[model samples]
Target: MHTRYGSINREMLIKRSPGWRWIDWEELSHYRDLLYFLTIRGIRARYAQSVMGVSWAIIQPLATTLIFTVVFGNFAKLSSDGAPYLLFSFLAILPWTYFSSTITDASVSLVQNSLLITKVYFPRMFIPLASALGKWLDFSIGLLVLVVLLFYFKAAPGWELIFLPILLIILFIVSVALGLLFSAMSVQYRDVKHAMPFIIQLLMYLAPVVYSTHTIPLAWQKWYVLNPMVGVVEGFRAIFLHHPMPWNWITTGCGVSIVLFILSAAYFRRMERGFADMA
Candidate 1:
């Protein structure tokens, strides 16, 4: 009887080991309230007492669309794959702005919250996640502008519109992946802070934001898709402009991006233990 009790106790311990030894999913769930609060805090802090408030969201992307329309649409005579210049540029800019801004903010979230890091014991992931989530507000506003532009141009989205949400989710994941990777690097190297803006600016031109992917040679298209954003930008145009979905490129880019996200997340968690001390 005593031997039976010992074996049963051993089984109980083994069953409980996961809860004690590994990632505590339940613990994270319990902190859902905390995540909600942090997300709200980030949103409020962003727009607090700003003159334009949420309207800044619409203005930023709208202004970029206008500039691109002049430079690329008029002077450069860039082909927009039969779509109106304003409509073409606005759709691409919407996702680009969201990705760029989220990446920039998330990469610095920990450093910017150094005080909170030093003082508190919440999950460090919350900082970047909250920053990324906050940008959705801007994305939402930009989306509204896109709809208005479509109406003014008398253009209706094609059947490919069904894929827009999926493409946006992929873009979001890509942005967060890159953000976490850089955020981890930034903790160790301050130069990344200074380099980020220039890097993003360069990436913008490299992406098909102001022009169509059709401009690139067919032979080189596969290689260009390796840029990841190549697929995203093209995919956005395909959906919004009634072009065929770049399925092969989108698949390649989304697959690579998802892997990158997983790897970057692992790296972040591994390094996260040291962040409180380092920050």
Candidate 2:
């Protein structure tokens, strides 16, 4: 329709445009309720049709810890900085599992919700963030298991435990940042689905979940901290097991993670406009 001034309406005009648009933080805030609903829906769907349900969360990490203790701790005789190998490994696994699962689910979130993407207009970031929340349920279950394990081992965490919550916050941010990057890429490249498992598996080994960082040579220690999870896994052990704080590693890793987060957020916003069409 023409404007009252007799010019064509700007809104009705079509022009071929390319390149990214700035992220609209206000629009995302306006959709906060929708994000909450999606998050709740995701959490519910996770436990809805399972036989063991939430118990699997406890079982998976518990079993992994046992296996690592036997193979790496007993057979390989890996050191855990004087703490029991089982305790050290389980603490590391808790955060590792949460981070790994969140990234995996968030990566494919958009494609999995293609029906919604194709038919609706909403903040696309909610899809991946919602999936990440679903994985948090698993983290909660694992955390409970960790408490029980500590009780069984008769190991009370010391004052260093105070740092755990801060470490966890950093872990969550790193996961979400990496998740957002992969989620955006997955929209354009379906191969990410096939490759994600191998990538995660490789990351698991690269992380110090099964072994102590103390085993690494002094020369390699600084370089090792560059892997973001190095800080997270080691930080967990240092806090819960009362090992010396890996301050240099934690500081450097946190800095790297923040940079990654900013870059990922910018890239995600830049590519987000094409998501609906790509999905």
Candidate 3:
């Protein structure tokens, strides 16, 4: 009886230990090659049979920026902090596009990879991570357009450009956090994927993508930065347009993004165990 029990325990241990752990850095490291493979797969899958292919990246944001310039910049006469309306709108749209795509892709990653989730035993976060990374590749491609727009408008890059990476890291953290949270919930509810586009649209307006937050009444602006993207967009413009960088807004954005990221990641890890069953 003792020998039999020992064999069973060893089998259980082997089966369980090889599976994902809660925030296991070492295990994730072991599977880094899989992450690379999935990320490249995601990029290829995005443009697989499309004729336009990766050019779609620049076209989407460029088209939206042009529409915003005509509608918001021309018709509504929205302020762009004295910058050229087209360049102003494009800068905001750039980051917003990156953030929106990251969340959208990452949120649906697990459900979309249902077969892999059930058949494989790896850190499922890789699904979202790879999705986010693939989208990051798109964002990098899109930046070439932004550079062209900057030269077209004669907008000089500012010293604050150095801080752009830090800001992007914060935004990326929030994207992954929300992605993981929703991806996990989506496995169970199915409604999350349905609602995500609408939710992201609402968030885009709340952000300063189309118009400057300065257009808001002074009293309300303080409450507005609570949205996080308020600071993010402002910071981006400050870099590209060489506008003023308010320490207060940047600090608030960094802090809020960090806190939300941590809480969302914890929630995701808690919900992750059920993903295989529901997915």
Candidate 4:
């Protein structure tokens, strides 16, 4: 059927493709407004009824930073790579918080929207994609706290600051990649919702969030960088904490994220055919 907006006319075609189908870029672009609305809706739904609302974004990382400072910095004496332990942990926590929270919401996105999924023909990918996008509001607010820390420490990022956006983009892709995989799987198996928090908790220890990469044994460092967040968290410190950029880790992690995104997108599309039935 044809949809008319003002004088412009657009046709949306719906049909079944027999085999596995990849993302329909053009089709998604046509539905861009839906993605925007969903993203906004998610942001509002998360903060609407809360008393503190957006302030929770600033509080979460600060609270985590305080706990880590007391336990790891004071007692255990974990290396913060020479920066103040508080700033170091907060920088890592900023991205990690975004990554974890996005995944948590995205994983159950399809299941939560089962009614819409069963009734609609839009790209299912948007559900998780919107979740990822919505969490950036929290991340952006957290950045303000990061700036305050930067000023308090009198630390300045040198030329390496230019790479921050690239690092964040890679981080975003990593979140979306896993989000797609888990969101699709959760539609078929309700257990994914239960297991996700535990998985994300374990993943935090795997990444160099509370400690520096220097703690990793030299021999295992190469293999450890394969986890994308290792690079992202380390890169975040390198830029904000004024440490040397770890290009090897960052490049390796970026490559892994890209490959994972392709595989996850393929799997999500392959499973898309059954989402309405299963959801």
Candidate 5:
């Protein structure tokens, strides 16, 4: 059978390669608005009916900081690297909370938004990325509380403050990478949803969130930097508590984060082709 348009009749065959690319940047860009809306929707859904609303962000880190002050600061006698114990613990908790929360949400973002996944053709990566974005707003609010603590303590960041944004980007990279990897896996195995919080809780102790890295033996320091958040939590305290930048930890951690991001992106891409079907 032949169909004619105007004066011409033609038959065309279209084909797509069997293999998928790590990312379709152009395709994602076309859906940027969708990403923004998803992020906004997430934030709203979180606080829409809450009594405390956005204040929950501040309360979470603040409450954790208070507990850590009693448990680690007074009882354990861990040094705060110069700043008061409250500021130090909160700074560490700041990034740690952001990282943990983002990862937790991203891990289940695909499952939570199964309806959207089933109905959409956009980049599946957006689900995890949008999950991260929602948490960034909470992080920003918690950061303001940190600044208030700094002023209350009469503390200010040194020249190393210039590296604050870079450190946050590194934190974001690692969190998003883990989020992508786990979110994809969760689509196939529902257990990731249940275990994610416990995993984050265990990671908090291992990553130097409640104590300075100075206490860890020098011999084990390099091996400890293998946890990317070792760079993030410590780097956060270094900048916020007005201490020297730990170049060794930061560099190694950043490198590891980049590598993980690349690997996770590839893995997510491979798994995402079946996401809508699985979801």
Candidate 6:
């Protein structure tokens, strides 16, 4: 009886020792319910006290697209790769908004939840994961608006429509990758919070959100696709406008996202060892 009791005690100790793992799938699954509630709470809390509520999601991209249409499309007379300038900018804005919002919220998630982080033993990664996942609601609302614009323009997608899912997956990977890295750094150094906005603003221009990638000179085109969102935005336009797929850009984005995800996950896990102490 004592031997059996000792064996049970050992198993309990082993189960409880969830050390800093890079990506512990089993441990995350064990706490899946926590992740679910955290994601739901983030979604509700996001719009609960807002004046416009969920409409803010649609308004942001729509407003930005209108400004770009006026300035870049009309004034500058930029190329839209043959698609309507309004539709072109809106397509890029959808993913850019989602990517920006996710990382922005996630960058402060750890600090915001310091109380819980210090007191809880669950996976710390869940905090940022919840932030990243919550933005899907906003993305879906924007996607609905995109559908309406597609009809208004009478555009039709072809077999290339199948590539959309892959592009979306890469977009998600890029967002979460940066989200994890920024959140981890934000915990130890508050400067990440202040610098994040400028970083995001810089990235927006870098990724061709306000202009067409075609406008990028042939000399710079190879280096330009290094920004993962280049592929994502151009892929969206290709699908909606029935243009040929930008295979090189898309593949480069996939490779870059994978590398970033691996590095960010490792860095996040390493940094999390001191999170409770830092919090």
Q: Give one clash count per candidate, in the order shown.
A: 0, 0, 0, 0, 0, 0
Decreasing lDDT order of the candidates: 4, 6, 5, 2, 3, 1
Candidate 1 residue pairs in clash (backbone atoms < 3 Å): none
- The model with the greater TM-score, 3 or 6, is 6
Please state the error at residue 89 of candidate 4 in Å: 0.4
Q: Write the per-residue lDDT of candidate 1 for residues 58-167, one digit (tens) a residue.
A: 88989989999999999999998888888888888988998899889988888898899889877677778787888888898888888888888887888888888778
Q: Where in model 6 is the C-alpha error above 4 Å? A: 1-21
lDDT of 6 by residue, 1-279 (tens): 344233555454444334456687867887899999999999999899888999999999999999999999999999888779999999999999999999999999999999999997888999999999999999999999998898899877778988889988998999999999999999999999999989999999899888889889999999999989999999998888888899999999999999999999988998988899997
Among these predictions, the greatest TM-score belongs to 4
lDDT measured at residue 238 in model 6 versus the true structure, 0 to 100: 86
How close to the true structure is residue 15 of candidate 5, measured as C-alpha lDDT? Answer: 58
What clash count does candidate 2 reach?
0
lDDT of each: 0.82, 0.85, 0.83, 0.93, 0.88, 0.91
Residue 80, model 3, lDDT: 88
Per-candidate Cα RMSD to the true structure, in Å, reads 5.6, 4.6, 4.8, 2.5, 4.6, 3.5
Over 4 Å off in model 1, which ranges?
1-27
Model 3, C-alpha of 10: deviation from truth (Å): 10
In model 3, the clashing pairs are none
Query: 6-121, model 3: which lDDT tens digit per residue?
Result: 35554434433323335767667878999999999999999999999999999999999999999999999998889999999888888888889988888888888999988988
Task: Please report, as a residue range, the 10-residue window in candidate 4 with the lowest summed lDDT.
Answer: 1-10
